[model samples]
Target: MRIVIVDDDPLVRMGLKAILQSEEGWTVVAEAGDGSAAVAEVRRASPDVVLMDVRMPGMDGLEATRLIVDSGSPAKVLVLTTFEVDEYVFEAMRSGAAGFVLKRVPPPELIEAVRVVATGESLLFPASTRAVIERFSEAGGYELPDLTEREQDVLRELARGHSNQEIAGHLYVSVETVKSHVASILTKLGVRDRTQAVIVAYESGFVRPGDAAEL
Candidate 1:
């Protein structure tokens, strides 16, 4: 996977580059000190993923993410933040970030997050992300689509953070079947990914925050 690291801290950028370069089939194509530089680097490198820091001296990651996404760049953004539940992280997601990981995340998990986002899947950081979604979704009040009973079952599993493979196993179906359900779910709900779908499920009262365990 090709990646660009964007952080104001030199040491942080270097450390991340070292970690990513150690892995096979991964390359650090570029590095930028701040968000503006990040935009330029992304445009020039055309990387598959960007590890973007939230706070910076100028043009913070949230704005940078908006510009990148609005510009229709294919690269997915994975925001890096020091705080676990900052409002800026939520803003980053709204700005079209694929997901976020805490700065203190373990190296293995960080690498895994990059791989997940690179593959066009949304990364949900369970505790932190779910909390953010719940708080914001409650305010926005999502509207549910006309999903069939089986689709609702699939959505409930999705809201619980189950993967396509895991959902298939739980529903006694194939992965491709789960993918089909997921696509239909996205289309019906008029959302982008599973993360947004889950948010809608929660906001629309299709799936309660506590329903995951009961389902």
Candidate 2:
């Protein structure tokens, strides 16, 4: 996979580039020290993924991510953050980031996270999602006014990180049914991917963070 690494710290960018390049079939096409540079590199390189730091001197990753996605770049932005509950990380997700990885993550896990994101096979939020929502969400009790009850069920299942197959089985519906529900949820929420949609679920309290295990 072709990738871009973005961080304000040169050392952080170096370390991430080295770790990512160690994997076979992966290439670090470019590196950037901040969000504007990151966006430029992404345009020039057109990488499959961008490992983006949330904090930077200018244009922060959140805005860069918005600009990239809005410009119709196919590159997936996988956030690099030290804290999972960072308000910026939440904002990045809402800006259309594919997912995130903690900076202190083991090399193998970080590599795997990138691979998962690159393949477009999954949304990578884990149990840390709960902490992020609870710590950063501005409000609760928001309703899914546009979704049907069944679409709401599918959205909650999405919060659990279930695949379409899993959600279909759980809801006693076909995978196609789950896919349609997911598409509708995305449309109603006005987001790009399930990760963004699920963030909305959490922020809206439509799927409370604590409800993950039970749902």
Candidate 3:
């Protein structure tokens, strides 16, 4: 996967580039010092993934993510943040970031996160992510879409961070059936992926952080 590392700190960008380069089939196509430069680099590189730092001098990662998504770039943004409950990280999610990873994450897990987001899968950090959403997300402002009872159940399972296989086993249904429910849920919620779906569930009072055990 081609990736652009965007961070104001030169050392952080260099470190991330080194870590990503050590992985097979991953390339550091470009690097940017700040959010505005990151946007330009993304346009130039056309990378599959962007490792975005949430805070920057000029545009910031959140605005950069918004511009990239609005411009119809296919690159998936994976935000890098120091704080798990950062308000900017939540805004980044709203701007269409695929997911976020902490800067202090172990190299293996960080590499895996990049791969997962690059493959068009949402990376939900169970404990910290859920806590952040629950803390910041206001309840009962927006109306939820019409979902069947089974779909609601599936959504609840999803909010609990269950994979399709796990949701299937829990619901006593086939994995294919669970996948169907997930797709339907995503469509009805008007969200990109499972992470956004779970965010909606929490924001809509459909699920609470304490309701599920952390993975």
Please report, in order, the local distance difference test score of every candidate based on alpha carbons.
Answer: 0.83, 0.84, 0.84
Question: Number of the top candidate by TM-score?
Answer: 3
TM-scores, all candidates, are 0.88, 0.87, 0.91
Candidate 2: where are CA atoms >4 Å away? 140-145
What tens-digit string does per-residue lDDT give for candidate 1 at 25-143? 99999999988999999999999999999899989999999898887898899999988777888778777887788889889989888888787554455666766665665534566
Better of 1 and 3 by lDDT: 3
Candidate 3: minimum summed lDDT over ten consecutive residues — where?
A: 120-129
Model 2 RMSD vs true structure: 2.3
Per-residue lDDT for 26-72 in model 3, tens only?
A: 89999998888988999999999999998888888999999988888
Candidate 1: RMSD over Cα atoms?
2.2
Model 1 TM-score, all chains together = 0.88
> Which residue pairs collide in model 1, if any?
none
lDDT of 2 by residue, 1-215 (tens): 99999999989988988999999999999999889999999999999999999889978899999999999999999999998778889888878888889999999999999997886555675677556755676546777667888998888887777778888999999988888888888888887888878778877877664687744
